[model samples]
Target chain A: MTEAVELWLVRHAEARDARPGESDAARALTERGVRGARRLRRALRRLGASFDRLDHSPLLRAVETADVLAPLASATRVNAGLAREPGPEFLSDLASEVARSHVARLALVGHEPWLGQLAFWLVSGWSVREPARQPAWLALEKGGALRLRGEIAPGRMRLEHALDSETVRALARR
Target chain B: MLHLAQRLDELRAHAAIARVGADSRGVHRARATAGRIAAWLDLGGWSVLADDVRWLRRGLARARDLDVIVESAELAPDARAWFARERAAEQARVVVLLDDERFAALLAALAELPEPRGKHVRRALERMQRRSLRAGDALERAVEPLDAAHRLRRRLRRLRHALEWLELPAPVLRAAQTELGELHDRAALLGALERSPFERATRAGRDARANELEGRLASFRLRWPALRGELRRD
Candidate 1:
């Protein structure tokens, strides 16, 4: 039996510009990015955000953001799967993982396009067959987070709200 | 095996200086001591204090950065004055951190830490060594190696500290750390020079710093192979 889950899908904060010859994955967060992530953490705490687990991409920026928000989760792990784009199998695996772990709430910190695409899929359904047919309404900015609730299966989840980085920071300041 | 008490004493002493409005050296020492304590805590399996240590370090970060920039980078006189003023403003934030309630709780936790069990020490050192090796491997494959090198530098520091705690010699690790440290400093200087105003006055100095950065990068690339080999042996 699967329990309803609250999934917080987060995009990693603004990354520093890559130096010459640097890999994209090796780029770390800028100082401003760190501050933004910390503010997001504080805002989440203020709103009483809690999660069963925090999973982040293996990439440096996501890992760093995850570290800042780790106090919200009971446990944290580096999920290499998050470093890749989501597909149908990805959602299936996620559903199974959530069921097995009994995770009622989870936070996923990852990169763009991937996170945007995942959020799109969860809110909309597989009815949009081609990737090109998907709407752009779910795009997330750096440091933004989307809160989804309900079943873990794709297309079944409800989009509670999507917050931009600025809003989150403003909320945090309040 | 960490002398938690001694480490805490060092943090307190340096933090006292920092809280009173730190000079550049005081900021450096306070930050370094806090980092050492954090690393020691990691090695000893004191996971509870991780957040506190991270919070403390984050609070000190700006102060440390300004200190390093002032000490290592060549700035136009006007730029130097501007940075000094900014640094002075930042000291107030650092002082506030020292008086924060979380800091007091961190101190109390450090005071109560027990010596790590002997069995855990070897396991912990092995874990740290593995992490360092992974970081070194990432550095080799990195397209932009500077950021990777910086990450490796941090892992290397933790490994060196763990070895020191165990009374083991780590001369190669120490040497590699120093080389990486110089490279990082040069890179920081180049970055600061790039952003500073008074560009016309600072151009020659910036170009010189750029060349220095390239030289250090090349030197580090040459040394990394042998360093990785040493890490593998350990």
Candidate 2:
């Protein structure tokens, strides 16, 4: 078997508040968002974080997030499997893909519902449709990241640690 | 915009405790043990019964890695004592990583995924596929070079990893891996014997080791037709 994989799941940094009819995918990061993302880089280094590869949603905020945290690789990747309204099937496919990514440490920079639903499905194989059986939902704040290490196989991963934005800011203070 | 030096000062004084839990430790060993169990489901099934032993191995390795990390890091006196005790307790205890229920859960959940493998995943899978093909070609040569044969074994092992990831059937690749692995081991043993002091001191020892290696090599060759046939069938 390949080595155990580490997924550093991240939500994109703050973005400009949307304009009326402004496509969410076209929305760029605000100045504050950029600063927050740079801080994220500092925080990752502080935590001794490194990655073999990274992926992001095609949306602008997510792409910029990936650029700031982890520069885009040579290959153009498809969506990170994190839709704004992700469901069980999406998260399941994400895990299935993760299982095959073969990377020792892969960082996925994307959006919320993807990370939240993913957190749920990872800890418990059930999704929101079966919320009665789902475990606690993990909230990954903007500029926050969770370090997960294990099999990407459903219900097999253990959340090694989760750091909220406040916690990360605190950690990055020095 | 920043108070960077002070920030560094605060974090340098203390580190987070590493005693996450039994669940976090031994992930690799646990999954491998589970695989071994799955592989031997219909056989004598000692693999299933040996679950406790696998857990023990996992616990030991996790605790050791934890201790090594803590001992090597700078920490407050209080933190050091806390880690020392945790390490001691960790060293003394063991835990099972997977039960039959979780194993079945993993299989079931993954089986239901709706999408085809993602782009990065598929690229990696195709790379392994190509490598396995090359290995197969190496094995099919008119006079297979030992090095090429060794590569075939490595390629098969890699193909197994990819297949396992894809949840594809891998017994054929695994069987080929086992055969090539044994062949490599015997070849290595012969190399070691050739380098031994006793073998160097006596011509008889040298000749005996050569004969043993030749016998094993011939036996390994005898399996080729069967291996080729197996690969063809798969």
Candidate 3:
């Protein structure tokens, strides 16, 4: 039997308005947002959550945040499919691409709808309530790192792991 | 009027001499000076048109040696009509000499008039030359910083492309780290989906793919920070 995949989901910090009447691609991370990302990086290190590969949204804000955290953990790559507005088809494609890679523990830094949906799929097998608007995190632990065949449920995930910047900072320091 | 004609000939001669070894900046300055000279000629009573003049090829043209060409007797009408046609075709005012015998004789007589040594004409020519030199220097200075930025962006892009071709020994571990980073971006998207009408009926599937990538990336980081740094730098 294969071990269950351990997934870590992280949301990007605050960013300035992208453009006056344009898409979110133009947005950039604010100073406070950068600090928050650094804090998260520290927390992941303290938690002993070692990642082998780092993937982030191609959006500038997400990319910048990932760049900050990547030096502390692993090599970072930008994946356009992980963007906030990806559809169901895109998520499925991402899952297949990831499955083929055979990574054990993965961390993704992206936006809202897609991440929330990904979390719901991982926990409930069916999406439950909407994911939190603020930075929310989910950790999944299943047996055998090769396939996600085990009894997957919300119980396997832990909330409040990365709810705020202060807590994340403390975790990093620890 | 005769003095003005001699002065114009001298200015044209000077312009022709300046065109040798001139770059784009130098050419522009020379053309501007020629324009000013043409403007002064218009103020005089000579029916001379400086329109459609090939300022760039001034020194190269054989016609520069000839003072005037006569093809007809109506000097003003023929010269004005040729000037209009040339200007329309070239999109610039060019100089043309009339084809009238009397007018040509008059111009020949004027060309013999003693040239003026006015300081204003000399000063204007010098200023145009100086302006061209400044423009050339400014262009040289602007390239360095712009090149640096362009090189950095290209290096980063190449590194990203190279990663696609790598087949690491521990694929699962690499996949996990990659997924973790991806999850960060996706989570933000999920947060926004709550406000939209395109709600999904089924949650995205729980997969082990992301975890494997993260684990791989972590292991690689521990083993090869130096390579990663090199990749980022280049």
Candidate 4:
């Protein structure tokens, strides 16, 4: 059976471009991205996001972002499968991880393209009939996060909303 | 599990969905608002009427296999109006079917399954690659009917989809597709030019346009192998 969970997919704050030869995995978040992460934290709290657990990719930027938002959730960990591009298998791993926590909601901090891909997959499979063109590839700007609510299964989740940093900040301020 | 599956089915059948699968996964329901009983399927044909909802079997998911490979039965209707209404007045009561520990196992079980999505993508990619090679041979030979640039463009697009599904790095393939798409557009325009009433009006000037189109086409072809090479990193 499918579980209805509020899954929040967070793209890491901005990171400096990998120095000429620096490995992308080693790069840390930029100061502004750090601010965005902070804003994300405030926003999640304000929105009363009850995340049972939070995890991020091993990459420095994603780890840092998770650290910034750590206050919103009870615990944080480096979830291996969340690190790179989220293939269909990654999703299964994630859903299983959430189920283990036994929480209806969880937060995932990670990189782009993958996050967007997951978001796209969750909203609907690549083939969708729509009023709004379900993202073929969602572009979640730096520090942006998308909320999915409804049944959690392979392709049963629904796109609740996409939040920008300022929106989070404003919501938090409220 | 059985109860939850039944509930999910009821939701999909009675309610309007937000985003469904990216490629082929089926429709999913957004939490609906209060007092908003789907009075009738007002959206359009193939869409259910809210007033008299008759849920289909497709809406029901697998209780045994937690990871559902849900397919949207159809992707033609525009459900924007209904969705917008749902958004405006949603007072949805949220629910979660599986507890945390169980949820975790179900998700992981899906991944560890004999033929998970990743494996499925691999198979799909292999099939697309075989088809691409056949298309490539025809493309290289510039076979008359099959040699059309549009056909090649279509082939590239399918290959791109497979690459995406497989989560493979596809910049080169993307660039190739874009170039082919542009070439297809130019070829189409050139063909249209030849058939237009204007072509007879200026028959003598047409050769210059044709030469330019052919030149671009040849250049695109010359670049195809290099682009194709980038995708073959086996």
Calculate the i-RMS of every candidate, to one decimal place.
Answer: 13.6, 17.4, 33.9, 18.7
Predicted candidate 4 versus true structure: per-residue lDDT over A52-94, tens digit per residue: 7776676667766776777677655556566556666666676
Looking at candidate 4 chain B, the ten consecutive residues that score lowest on lDDT are B39-48
Model no. 3, DockQ: 0.00
**How does model 2 score by TM-score?**
0.40
- lDDT accuracy of residue B90 in candidate 3: 31
- Model 2 chain A poorest ten-residue lDDT run: A71-80
Candidate 3 lands at a TM-score of: 0.36
Which residue pairs clash within candidate 1? A21-B143, A21-B144, A22-B143, A22-B144, A23-B144
Clashes of each: 5, 3, 88, 30
Candidate 4 lDDT over B1-234, as tens digits, reads 011233334444433332222221222232221001111111111011111121111222221011111111211123223323332332121112222232232222112111124444455566656666566656767845225666766666666644443355678767767777656544544454454444565455457656776787777667667656766752
Off by over 4 Å in 3: A1-3, A85-88, A128-163, B1-234
- Output the number of the DockQ-best candidate: 2
Worst 10-residue lDDT window, candidate 3 chain A = A140-149
The estimated TM-scores of all candidates read 0.58, 0.40, 0.36, 0.40
- Greater lDDT among 3 and 4 belongs to 4
**lDDT tens readout by residue for model 3, A83-137:** 6454556555545555666656666777765666566565545543444432233
Candidate 3 lDDT over B62-129, as tens digits, reads: 22211111111222454435433432333221223222222232233233222223453345334433
In model 1 chain B, the worst 10-residue window by lDDT is B105-114
Fnat of candidates, each listed: 0.00, 0.00, 0.00, 0.00
lDDT-based ranking, best first?
A: 1, 2, 4, 3
lDDT of 2 at B87: 56
Q: By DockQ, highest first, what's the ranking?
A: 2, 1, 4, 3
Q: List ranges where model 4 is wrong by over 4 Å.
A: A127-137, B1-234
Top candidate when judged by TM-score against the true structure: 1
